[model samples]
Target: MPDARTTAFDIDLYHIDAAYLAWKSGYNAPSAFELFTRGTPFRGGYMLTAGLEPAAEFIGNFRFTREQLAWLRTIKPYEDEFFEMLGAFRFTGDVYAMAEGEIAFAHQPLLRVEASFVQGMLLEAGLLRALGIGTLIATKSARIRTTVGNCSYADFGFRRAHEPIWATRSAYIGGTDSTSYVEAAHRFNIPSSGTIPHAIVQAYPDELTAFREIARLMPKYMLLLDTYDVDQGIDNAITAAKEEAANGSGHTLMAVRIDSGDLAAWARLVKSRLVTAGMGDVKVLVSGDLDEFKAQDLLATGAPIDGFGVGGNLAVGLGSIESDYIGGVIGAVYKLSWIDLPGDDDDRMKIAGSKSTWPGKKAVYRFGDFDHDLVTLDHELAPDGGRPLLHPWMKEGTLLHSHPSLTEIRERAMSNLAAMPTWLKALAPEQDYDVRFSDELVALRDRIVAEHK
Candidate 1:
């Protein structure tokens, strides 16, 4: 695990320079930065907020280490005063954010930081990374959850995950029933599940022996098929299951996993064979570079697949070529939105072409089953029947409250997913949910732009 006490050196050198320059030039006004993405990931209608726990931790514990400061002295001819400031620095800011697992739209502020200009600048990279990757994985898992419907889904992507720990947590938040990452499971109290690998079957003289041994050891076990011959593997599994039942050793044959071949066809065949052998209750779980699209296709074929164990597609964010839509990446950017100087408060924005951003501290108000969202200046009154999505997370550098449990976040994700409009849930949604800016927010942006002109 990385240190919970994030050091100032964790940020990019440019951000450090920017902060240094700001401080040197006496530009030490309070500033607000909003973390938002310009568009949804995976061509989806919405994203699930995640990584708030880590982001908050980073902000709460942000400090400069002695070693880091010593190293900084070697790199640049910065003054002793700056080092003194760095050594004494602590984040004394406020953070407002949507709860983890809350559904968010493009341009909505998932997290907003109210701090000094230097503090806000220093937080840009870390906040973006933590929230961006976490949100991407969570959104992908949510799509998979939608595809699988009531069927079981588990994360088998640890080996392929960019960061196994975060991926596992995000996957669970996205509605997976379990994860194969044991460490993550232990840390987060997520249910961990897995069966023998193909290598284990290869280690044995025959499939039946391996199956028998696994059944003897485990109270319940899923046999791995397709290591050699699918038919022989299935036959051996059935034999082992029957023998285990007759032996009265209290072992249960829970399911059989198919990792290769035409998964849908194989699942149907496996289901029929299990039913014929009086083991119909046993599940048929399939895994092989699977994603929501493939899972949906397989289920549509009525493959009798009871569960999915997704690996690479779930762990890694390699976008699909067929869909021509990038996966596994959320382009969340942290931009300065408001600056509070002595007796002067200024709204800020970026107007470089399509990258223009909304000015001022903002609030997102959701209404009517996520049918519409209104973005307005933070101080604006909520539209009637509007539910404010952003809430106070931290005040004066201290967390206002503890985060909800992972299970609670997962439930929230599922509930939000269920509330999504039917058309938005489609694998290729053609319409976007209504997201609009309040007239005041638009007017503020216009005024800022006109002033710049």
Candidate 2:
């Protein structure tokens, strides 16, 4: 094998140091502190600091192998100078961030990385891409988790998701209690659970045969109905469930999942049939491109659906969020603010319309009473009084503290979700959430925007 020295770092660590070095040089920072300081390059009340741990790992262990460097030589405009620079890149930066699973509103910085412009700038792409996508999914997951109440929601979007890892990470982060993809579950420590697929049901001569075989294999399993005849499918599932229950195999009739037809009516009919047959304990799980609007509407009907299996719409971020919820496509640019060295002030700005960024490090305060958990539109709490939501996650390519485990993050997510008003968690928009900017950040943005004009 080629010597480790000649290789690019591990896949996870591939971009951290290089990204940091690139960022620093790209922005021409005199020192790392200058790139992330108050009145320095990054100007915002605060950054929504995320993906630092992975980014840090990337930087600390970054080394381009002879193989990677050789590939570099294959490209044109490959300056010996740039190649030489790439040879020695390593990331060393400080990052302040919100704890994973913290409730963040639009326009708020979720995580911020502070390092020399060279180091920080280099790390930008991988860091943002890693953190932004996950957080976006996690935020959406929190909302969906909120609406589901006590019912179990599983991730069924793997086959339909944009990618495999998304099926794993995004689905789990979003509030799916389980997944049908075993690999996704194994990779992310998510639970894997499911009922029979239509293909399996299609193979059998009749629905009863399919149900008998399935129940025989996994006695405690949930069974899928709605193949040829919806009513017949339910009757078969009931018969199979009853046989499994009677065997005293400790397998009670778990659930009958419905995937087609009018879900509300079908669910009611199925429940009525099950109840009539003394299968009151059997649940009715609904799936099939369910979104918040559909789920909420179904819930409004007081149907017999014990659980909902939302697929494409929830997993892919469909109509749940309005374009305006993106809120003016607010430019949250990461910019090169001030670079204060001995005799040079490289305090400059990027081009306009590229999303202007504020200068200096910053923070935000959310003011409200604990009662009913109200977050006022413009009223900010005294900075000292309100609990600070953002904190230090990393410094100089080392983690500042143990990032909370995924379970902890999930728990925190649930709490924040519980505090939100039902209307805010509604599938459709009533109003944009109100969040105030600190006077400091507001003033800084104004100054920068005016300068750009």
Best by TM-score: 1
Question: What stretches of model 2 exceed 4 Å from their correct place?
Answer: 1-27, 30-63, 76-78, 320-334, 341-354, 369-382, 450-453
Question: How far is each candidate from the true structure, as Cα RMSD in Å?
Answer: 1.5, 6.4
Per-residue lDDT over 1-453 for candidate 2, one digit per residue giving the tens place of the 0 to 100 score: 112342243333434444444544564454322112111001111112223334444555566666676675775344566667667666666766666656555444455666665555555554554455455455455555667777788777777765456434655655779888887677657777888789999998988988887877874788788878778988888888778767777665588899988999999999999889988888899998676556777888988888888666544544434222331111223444445455643444444553444444545445552211122112344354566655676777677786566566666666666666666665444465556555655665676667667
For model 2, what is the error of residue 310's alpha carbon versus the real structure, in angstroms, after optimal superposition? 2.4
In candidate 2, what residue range of length 10 has the lowest lDDT sum? 37-46
Which regions of candidate 1 deviate over 4 angstroms?
1-5, 342-345
lDDT score of model 2? 0.59
Task: List model 1 lDDT by residue over 1-453, tens digit each.
Answer: 346665566689998788889999988788999999999988878788888876766676678888888998999788999888888888888999999999998999999999999888988988998899889889888889999988989999999998788888988999899988899999999999997799998898988899889888889898999999888889999999899889999899998999999999888888899999999999999998888888888999988999999988877755666667688678889999999776665888999878999999999999989779999999988789999999998898888997789999999998998988878877678988799999999988888788888
TM-score of each candidate? 0.97, 0.80
- Residue-pair clashes per candidate, as listed? 1, 35
